[model samples]
Target chain A: MPDTGLLLYGGAFGLILIGIAGIVLSAHLVRIIFAVALLEAGANLLLLLATWHQGAAAPIIVAGRVPDLMADPVPQALVLTAIVIGVGILALALSLALRVQRAYGTLDMHEVRRHMEQDIADEAGIDMPSSSHAPAAVQTARQESGA
Target chain B: MQRLSSALFLLGLGLLIAAIFRGMEFGTVAPIVGQAINSAAAEQVGAANFVTAVVLGYRGFDTLLELTILFTAATAGGMVLGKRSPTAKRDPDAGFILQAGADLLFPLLVIVGLYIILHGHLTPGGGFQGGVILASAFFVPILARPGTRMSHTAVSTIEGLAGASFIFIGLLAMFGGEAFLTPLMGQGELGALLSAGSLPVLYLAVGLKVGSELAGLLAQLSESEAVD
Candidate 1:
């Protein structure tokens, strides 16, 4: 019989794989951030599951009766910390994506990368012959602005 | 082509995970750390909840570092999404139903969050969980009134003071002839609210610090969105 442990491990890794697939296949920056979130959620679930036991109750103490089987408290503590930190990092990622969208006018990863490279090249004063690049409009505009 | 590669990678990863999962045992008893914590936590820390003892007493230093990580993330997020000029347009307000719902639930959420944080020594919830609840409570208003910004100054001060006070309490424990973060006063009867002494106090500091940090993160994200 398949137990809860097997299900948990399977579920967590499944979510992680899905997240990785989303990150790799999706072009939109926002979807990529969501994929990152899925990855974090999977990791959090895995961390929490690592401490589970067969008959263990939650680590909370009742007034009179002492629990015979108490779940491990350390992983709960660790995962609590991870969840908060996950929120922080995800928010950071979202804000960065927002900035990227505002700057480039598109959320497509490829386009953003091309624009970012062009910006860097412009900043470094490297003259990239513009004939080969597809987004020549952005490059030509940069040239026209003398920026 | 891109989707094909991603699918191939995912299949490989899943295979690896399945292989790894097969080795792990299921339905086992608790680990050694849980046993030790359960046995000694009552006598040593005087906290009824072993989880609380682990978080606020045995592993207090790690909790402090966790708070620091949260603080650093908040600071970095604020820097990344710095204040925009006043001319930046605002996000549209939420609809009346959503706004009203948020307003109605906000106070209830705050109270529940406080209960969780305050009763952490005796219950399942603790500083980090309660703090997140409190932070979510604060976020309701932002959803209701799109342009309203949280006070960065207030949030920063709360965060800084709470972190400082956590360290200070640990120092006080050190002065009381115990190791750092050792419960200072006498551990009262188990399951009592004030029984855990420094444990509850540390939890309170943690709750405030985490709540403010998360609320600040939300506010900064909203502010950046509004500017855009």
Candidate 2:
């Protein structure tokens, strides 16, 4: 059986891998946001594990008794700060996603990207580059125009 | 082809992480500062929880900046969400069970949150953890009754005052010829509630600031008009 350290490390890394995979593979904006959160959580865990000791107690003094081996307080403090920041970022991301959904009427990543590109092109007063996958009629019309 | 490339990328990332993990020497790195703090924190900061001491004492600036970050994010989120349309329909009240549960949970959560915040220096819980519970205390009611709006004025007022008081307390320490955020007042008895000097006051400010900011942000998110 793997040691507890190995298991804990594995879980953290696993969360990071899954989060990255979700971000890369998922096509929904909300899923991507959630993946980002997962990645943040994994990173926080990894940070806390950086100063891990085998038999360390929490870094707290109880009733004038100090433990022989106490966990590092710095990383725990840092992780606490990081977690709050993560929640703030997540809330902002969700709010942004809500706004995007309101503006474009869809949450599908591809559809949103397409709409964004079209909006940019329109704003720039330039025609969008025609895709090879354009409808046959549209392609024929483009060929006939030759402009 | 895209999927294949994505899979290859992920596999490479996993291998890289695993390699780094294996290379790291766990349980061996000397925590020099941590050990020093462990020994000296009781006399210096007088907080039973060394983590709280480190958070609100040694690294108070970092905590302050973190609060600023939270404030910035909440403000930007609120701006992006904008105001709800006057005629936009609100979600109907939740079922009987949820309404009852939310009501039942409110006072209990507030008490627990305050307890955590008050005992932050003595135990594991602190401003951020307790603040989240306090936020939920307000947010739960909004979840149950969408028609009832939180008083944004009250939330913003609490948030502003709490944040100001945090900085004000830090400045107070500076007035006494100490560095910014140096814990003032004599370090009282270790492991006592009234000990830790200004740390608890700072944490009280932190908890209230975080609680109000989060509760307001959540209310804004929930009250926004639904996408058709």
Candidate 3:
């Protein structure tokens, strides 16, 4: 059998790889977002596992048990920071997807792109807005395109 | 062909996991953890909870950044979802038992969340875990009763207060001439419910802040103006 610490790392890394595969293969935007989130969490867990060894207890200060704090606290701090960032990223992605759904009337990624290309063709004069705030532009363009 | 590719993917994943375990040196690092925690970590940081020591003392700047990350997420999400979403159309049908049970369970969950946050230094759980619990508690009502109304304004108010209190606590620590998150050393009985200085208080504020913010975000997402 493999060493326990490396085993955990392996497990985490495998989960991450699976998550990435899901992101690539899944067509649904929400599923992709979830896949990305899973991958990120797995990465954080793997980083944490690298700092920890077997038989190491949680680094808490207990009376009469002034055991050496063997585990790396660096990973804990990093994971906490990552968790917050992950939450932010997920929320933003969901909100954007929601906006996309509202504007294009369907979440099929290709369909939305096609709609935009049509808009660009019709409007020929003005360059398209950046993707982040495309809805505002699409709303205006749709009024003119009327197709 | 698709099945073959999927089979290959799974096999590759298995091999990768096997490799990580095979390569790691697990036991050699044990002594290092002991040394870091027992003498060097404890004395250098004058706090009882070692995790707190790590979080508030050693990597306090990281904690500050984490808080800002949450703030940024809320702001970005709000901007995308809009500050105010239309109220959702009421479902108008709620089971009596679910409504009654949720009404009772809500306060209980809030209380438990508060208790966990306050006693974090003494107990197993801490602010983040407790915060999620509190959010779930609030979520019960929305699950059972579609007609139930949650005021975004009220949620925002609660969130603001909780956030301010967290900052205020940090300021208190700075004013006392310690580092940004230095636990305000108190003579309270160690291992008691209310010992360990400002750690418990900080945890409480964090729990409340996270819980309210998450709840507000959820309420905002599902909220659409109740269509006539």
Q: lDDT of model 3 at residue A119?
A: 83
Where model 2 places Cα greater than 4 Å from the true spot, the runs are A130-147
All DockQ scores: 0.50, 0.59, 0.27
lDDT for position A20 in model 1? 83
Query: Is candidate 1 or 3 superior in TM-score?
Result: 1
Give the count of colliding residue pairs in each prediction: 0, 0, 13
DockQ of 1: 0.50
lDDT of 3 at A132: 59
Candidate 1 residue lDDT tens string, B155-212: 9899899999999999998887888888878889988888877888889899999999
Which residue window of length 10 is worst by lDDT in model 3 chain B?
B26-35
* Each candidate: RMSD: 4.4, 3.7, 6.6
In candidate 1 the C-alpha lDDT for residue B146 amounts to 81
Tens digits of per-residue lDDT for model 3 on B82-154? 7444443455657899789989999999888877777666555667768878887888898787656677788
| Best prediction by TM-score | 2
Instruction: Order the numbered candidates by DockQ, best leading.
Output: 2, 1, 3
